[model samples]
Target: MAGVLIGLALLAFWLFSLFDVITAPEEEVRNVPKALWVLIVVLIPLLGGLIWMLRGRPKVVRDPWPVPPGPGMPKGPDDDPDFLRDLDRRMRGED
Candidate 1:
């Protein structure tokens, strides 16, 4: 029935929210302490879940492109200009 489906959906949402709260990193939790957020979600499932999703969740800012390593941190031999130049000299029989 429609009511049963709605109940199941709400239950699923509550469970997901609870899991999220438990797994969220301490530094990422906002508005209140992580323990307090967990208590809120456990005590008042629907409203707490909504509030957490809206306010407590971390504001993740993802870069579209992968970040290159900082200067002097070569990711690979090919990426290191000095290595490549040395390799080229060795290949050409230069000292």
Candidate 2:
């Protein structure tokens, strides 16, 4: 009946939550030691999920993806090939 269905639903939900805690990425779960995190999540299921998602959201950077260059590290020479090519073209035209 309705009671049985509700019990199964709750059990399924509980299992899903436990599985998520167990299998969560090490880095994510490592933020809170697994034992403590599991207890907190069990006590505040909605809050735990929200906190995890918010904190784990990947940061996006507008700069080139593979890590930006260090400060003062010029990306290219002032006289890089493209600049030299343009300079040569300008000189040829002028001459």
- Please tell me which predicted candidate would have the highest lDDT against the true structure: 1
Distance (Å) between predicted and true CA of 28, model 1? 0.9
Locate the minimum summed-lDDT window of 10 residues in model 1: 63-72
lDDT of 1 by residue, 1-67 (tens): 9999999999999999999999999998898999999999999999999999999988887986778
**Model 2: runs farther than 4 Å from truth?**
41-95
Backbone clashes counted, model 1: 0
Candidate 1, residue 93: how far the Cα is off, in Å: 32
- lDDT for 41 in candidate 1 is 97
lDDT of 1: 0.95
Model 2 agreement with the true structure over 1-95: per-residue lDDT tens digits:
99999878766666666567767655545456766666766787666655544553223437666776688665666636776778888989964
lDDT scores of the candidates, listed in order: 0.95, 0.64
Top TM-score: which candidate number? 1
Q: Between which residue pairs do clashes occur in model 1?
A: none
**Each model's backbone clash number:** 0, 0
